[model samples]
Target: MKKTIALLIITLMVSPVYALEALSDDALQNVEGQAGADLSLKLSINHKLENDKYVFDNGTGAVCADVQFCRLAVSVNNRFIDNNGQASSGDGYKLWLVFKGIQGTINIQKLGLDGMDLSYKDDGGADKIKAAMQLSFDATKPIEIRNFGFNALAFGQDKFLTTAGVEAGSTNASDYGYLQVTRYDTSNAPGSVYDHGRETGFMGVQMNGNLALQGKVMMFGCDASHPRC
Candidate 1:
């Protein structure tokens, strides 16, 4: 029994020597490029949001209705290159809201700051984020969203948010908040949308288990000071 135990110990020690085989050239090539512990992406949304009628909030505090929703686009680039041609892993946000069907683009091009709340970018590698939501609804459309303004800055960044709809009494007042994990109804998620990593930080309203245009008002997120909110 003693001899058997000693032999087993010797065999265990020797096994590692045989197992130390070198990786072949093909195997090395398969993993030649090492990966950083971060993921980066850019976002540009379109066509999914467009209608034949709408309203507008023209910075001057005037609400314009009977408008046509021509285009609503927002692009965010993570690996942005500046004038110096040097690249930095940061958030660069751009937005365009065109109404009246090719009439004009709202003056929201340069959102608050170049490096503001980064929740607008890819969700990974973020330390902290703050979000401001501006919402409005048209009591007359299939999609109650007359205008939805969503903007967030991560890692000490700043941003701008605006929206359009009926008077103050109809929509929720301006409220500041922080971002949170939002689970989308993914049962009907399109394959293409999921494959490209499309995500939204906002939640929508529904009526009686259906999409309806009622006077329902709700918001997501937490108090700006709600520790890790």
Candidate 2:
């Protein structure tokens, strides 16, 4: 019996033991939950004029010679209605909001995202819970945007109209569309010449700033519950 007991004790000491146990409420309360994650983002945009054309580089060694830059065009109020509420014109007549030649370096450090509850006033003036995404950043680290600029903010019937009167669907160099404002460069100027060292565009915006932003973007349904959905 003593030999058998000694052998079992040796086996128990060498082998691994597995067991399941229930935690008390207080113990569970003391347990720590998983913390969220952190994020860092950086964007570098560069552009230059080569042979009367604009070339782009996105921090990489490769250069884009095909007039490839960030461009966003939105058409608003494209549908025209007659007095009888009928369609009047085709999809040609559109007021375009174009943003072209976006070049800059954006740096954001330690941007945090987490789940949070948001409260807002309902349509009946009662406080309610609105779904939201919590966006938080380190106060010590501001969101930095350096050399931020765009070529144009044009408003016209077509998004592809050039200063040379070349309409849309033309496979010309001016096919990138007419810009109400352009960058301060010779390629944007008349006859490829700088206008007395002045920007030829309607407006020139050179933005470099460090912005501090921390908030929750609330999102909810556009139903009877939300007044300003």
Which candidate's lDDT is highest? 2
Tens-digit per-residue lDDT, 92-182, candidate 2: 3234566555676778976887654566687678876644456676767888877677754554333342232232454553433332334
**Model 1, position 1: C-alpha lDDT score:** 100
TM, every model: 0.13, 0.44
lDDT of each residue in 1-105, candidate 1, tens digit only: 999999999989888553567754335334433322222222222212236533223223333221112223333444333344454444221122211211221
Give the worst 10-residue stretch by lDDT in candidate 2. 158-167
Q: Which candidate wins on TM-score?
A: 2
| Clashing residue pairs for model 2 | 161-178
The local lDDT score (0 to 100) that residue 159 gets in candidate 1 is: 25
Model 1 alpha-carbon drift over 4 Å, by segment: 1-61, 64-73, 83-229
